[model samples]
Target: MESFASLFAGLGLFFIGIRYIGSHLKRMTGRRFRRAVAAATRRSGTSAIVGVVAGALTQSSNAVTFIAVGLVTAGLTEVRRAAPLVAWSNVGTAGLVLLAAMDIRLLVLFLLGLVGFAYYFDVERSARWRHVVGALLGIGLLFLGLQYIKAAAGPLRELEWMSAFLTFAGTADWLGLVIGLLGALILQSSATLTIMAVTLTGLGLLSLEQTLVLVLGSGVGSGLSVAVMAGGLSGSARQLAYFQVAVKLLGSLGVLLLFWLERDGGVPLLLAAVQALAEGTALQMALLFLVIQLAGALLSHPLQRPLLRLCASLAPPAPAEALARPRFLYDQALEDSAIALELVEREQQALLTRLPALIPADGQVAPPPAERQAVLEASQEVVAEVERFLSEVVQRSEGDEALERAMNFKSRNALLQALCETLDELMTALDTSNGSAGPPPLSVNLTEAAHALLDSLMEAGGEGEAVDPQLLRALTADRSALMERLRRDLLRNGADLDADQRNGLLAATALFERLVWLIHRYAVLLPDSLAEGISQKAPERAST
Candidate 1:
């Protein structure tokens, strides 16, 4: 009973320590990590190195996979470049597994002592160093827990139940693989399971062959775990997750076949190679775990194209993901300030065109709430990309004309972002107002008016269309007085409206007014000669 208690406690501590280390390491290096990933160009080697670093820092392949997904989704890098990063990250996770195989008792003591003094000094309270301190503390707890598990293992081998279980697990190589798979599925950490297997083998509770099969099974199980967790994801993001799954499964099963051939056919293979490198059973298992990861990377790299095609067929890109990617603005355009600014304008116009969709069409049934939210979020993402692109243009702009155009686009981008936000608020207000009695009559009218204003702005601001500034100014004219009067009338005459309905109506009206103002501001920033042939008829007016 004492041995069981110690083992469980150690496992608990190990799990907690891994969680802290992964999470804090992410928080500590997140921005720099993102920048590193974004900086990955067409060079496959650069991306692979980034992936290795990401895996090492996070100590989890799953983390690296998702970070790559996020970067791809954000248009920071392409799926092809991100693919290598995801593949090599698995290799990086082997660092911890190798570290765990060696003697770290003294290192554990040093870490705990340093952490103790740091905590006493309240280093955790400092924003800059908190993550560092927390990560170190997790390292201390991780090895300390390993020490406890090792201490418990010797006594545990003497137990009748434990002996029976070990005997059963070793009866067949396939059964050992199953045991490993199940353990990884439950724990969601193949490294953790592999480390435990190393511990058991070192204590003579399990033989090297049994431990190898277990490690192989854990590899496949880790992939399955990622697949299960990322089930909700779709499009390129889902494809990346599937890529991880492919590498893990292919690598682990391939190594398992090699192991069988060496053992049965007397062929020298991975087992013999590891034996030559290390003598101890624990060290050999660690080396094997690493070999399995490398095997996955090596096997999957050349097959990435076919595997990606398979993934795409299984999980096609979602509409929202397609919508989120910027239609224009490539890196090469940045070399020429003129071309880059033009691309920024085109992208901003594309974003503007999406505004009207936020409001449901009248007389037609409203779009699904999930569909609408996806569109809104996609627009926000594009808006962010536009802002980033414009910043690059600002840095490259040389003269007054180029600088002026860049600043103009920047101003318009700001207004466009404001319009998206205000429209979102307006939609939320309208949804809230639709109670048991349905939306108030005033809310319905306000939505229709806002929709009409959006249509006009879309036309006037659209590509190759000359904007009549005076006409646009009239179209988006301030309606504060009209809205205020309507609000007063609603309070005086809207007796049937519940409190929620009345508040919703007021909020909707306020947002609509702001929406109109934003549109007007956007129009005022439009260039005089929007298209080649068309000329500005209205007098030039100062930008408000």
Candidate 2:
């Protein structure tokens, strides 16, 4: 129980350290990672090499493979590109295993020292250092665990049951292979199993040929882990896992045939290759066996596209998001003055539709993930369609009043355009969120500041302002002001912000205010001779 508790504690610390490493890595390498992932999944060969490097660095192919699977399921990566990486990952593990087997007891000592350093380090002063130190400590514990494993296995070698098992495996290669494969599958640790194979062989209880069969089986059995993990994954993801199984199984079959050649009178050369590493230390022999495994990495390139096709066949049909409600003011049959003014008014209303929900609906305490994504995408399309439609209206503006109102709508809605974009970002974060992210307090204050300005302006009702360039200047200034405030707030508070997020909140206060101000300009444009009492009314506006 003590040993198990210690192991679990080590694991707990290791995962926490990995989380820190991944977080820092994201900030430092997000742009580079995007390009790298794109390049990887585009071609099977490159993907394979990348996978090997990634597994080697992280020392966990499961994590790398799962990432590849998720990307494939999301349709960002093709299965073909993913297969090569999966193949290369097995080869990568061999290198890591060899390193672990070597006497680098320094790993454990360093970790013990780092725990002391990290425990005393100041967080703000040593944020990045803390993560690095923590990660190093975790790696050290893992190596130390291997040392303990080596110690534990030492006694098992002397047991009568163990001696009998070794005798049975040495003489019966097929049974030996089956036993090796089953042990790895059951233990779920190829490294641990490899260590066992090496330790037993070193103890003189198992011959090189017996250990070699087991080594080969370990590679083949490792495929089962991914298959089980992929069960809940989508079709594209499952195909990625299945592809790994197929590649490993096929490789295993080739090894089986090589065994046949050696057993019969077929290939002396193949038999010689199999015997080369059989006489060495189990750890060294494990390294040599890995060379055979490394060939799979190269093989993965050729098999990439086949995997992609399989994933495509298995993937669920892609979801489409094209149906959106359009927002237009009353029809154009009204007078030229009324029509242009109404169009601007109608577009303004359309843009303001999501304000009540979006203004308070966002922050750290977000709305439902799916609903947020839908609203965001929906808002973007609305803004874009409005912009395109109004660009034409801007071209059709006739007199000073009509032309002015149209231009005013163009600018105000431009602010809405920003809102639409920001809302989309908030939605994406909310959709993927765990809901403990709390609130974006700074952004909330910025939004409230904006609403206050809008209310102030509306309550002031464009008093004493005329249709001169000053009116245009005021509208544009408000737009710029609100956007700047939102931008500043977001810069300070936006840890994981997406695009549409800041824009959505900014739109409510800045863009909506500008729209109302512009309409007030339009109302002013009507000739005193032709218009009556319109210029005297107060403005009451709502921003979508």
Candidate 3:
């Protein structure tokens, strides 16, 4: 019972260390790392190498996978290029297991002590060193936990029940596979489970063949865990998770085939290769894990397109769901306020782009209420998410420059939210206009004003072309004059419009004027920095 307790506690500590290490590494290098990875995706070979390095640094393949998914979803990288990234991430995660398999207890301890003393004295004043310190601490804890786990397992070799279980696992490949799957699922880390298997091998409780099957099962189990987490996500995100599963599943099958061939008096190629390079049982098992992932990546390289098609076919994205998602707001960017603020600016512009779709086209009926509602709801949700993200950024930010930028971003977010509300009201008024026998005189003016504003917005968003102050002043004056004239005409010909007609026209006039004014205000407030980031081609303005 004491041994079991020690083992569980050590496992818990190890898990925490792995999580801490991955998260801190992400925080430290997320922005630069993402940009580098995005640039490297021009070819699959380079992307795979980047993936391997990123996964090793972060100590978690899932972290690397999410980064790839985020880059793909953000339009920074193509989905096709992301396949090798996912493949190489699996290879990279094997590195941690390999490192853990080695007996580097003394060196790890010495480094931990050195870092701890430096941190204690605050020797490095830079904030960046804090993350480095945290990462070293995590590494230290990880190595210490392994030591505890080994000590606990060492006693188990003398136990009767433990020996019996190992005997069963060695004899039954399926049982070993099942045990490995369950262990990995419970731990939420295949690397952790693989290290435990290596410890068992060192204890002479498991054969190399049994350990290979278990390791293969651990790979599948990691994929299963990712699949379960991605169940609710749609589009490329869910597809990326499925892609991971396919690689592991195919790799596991290949290993099984190799096992069968070896059993049939064929060349035990894997064993021979491992024996040629590695000595100890644990090192040999570690070598086998790496060989499996390497083979899997090489085998899957040519099937990238077919595998991507299969993932999409299995979990196709719903159009509605995709629209509702916050496209430009990525969690990875949150680590850097500058990048996060830029993303918020981009998302605000994206929200603005949706507005023109609601403008009623000439000779066209108002859009259906369902369509209008969908656009409105999606717009509102993204705006809300952006606001929330900005709030988080503000809370985490330091220094005058970062705080100032966050404040400006918050202001822009508020303006976008107001614009969305005003546009929704205008859409309602346009729908009401359809009920009239003929287009009201004010409706035509409102449509023209909207079109003009939409065109100005597109030009500004695309080419960094600001709406001319002179043009804005002219449009504002024209809208005010038109509103004044409509009021006098309604009074002069009071009997022409019934109570309902009068109220509707008056409401439409109010919404249209407010919408135009809001657009003008937004154009004036548009920051030059944000305008420079928009795409080069101007988007088509909605016709009215």
- Best candidate according to TM-score: 1
Global fold similarity of model 1 (TM-score):
0.85
Error of 1 at 445 (Å): 5.3
Worst 10 residues of 1 by lDDT: 535-544
Per-model lDDT: 0.84, 0.56, 0.75
Question: In angstroms, how far off is 44's CA in candidate 3?
Answer: 1.8
TM-score of each: 0.85, 0.52, 0.71
Look at candidate 1 and give me any clashing residue pairs. Answer: 235-317
The weakest ten consecutive residues by lDDT in model 2 span 457-466
Q: List ranges where model 1 is wrong by over 4 Å.
A: 1-5, 120-129, 331-341, 357-371, 389-414, 424-448, 488-508, 524-544
lDDT for position 537 in model 3: 25
Candidate 3 lDDT tens digits, 294-366: 7777777888789999999987865654566687776679899889988887777676677666675565555
- Per-residue alpha-carbon lDDT of candidate 2 for residues 216-311, written as tens digits (9 for 90 to 100): 676677667667767776555677777776666655556656656766756664446645644446565565456546655555456557755665
Q: Model 1 Cα displacement at 227 (Å)? A: 1.4
Query: 1 or 3: which has the higher TM-score?
Result: 1
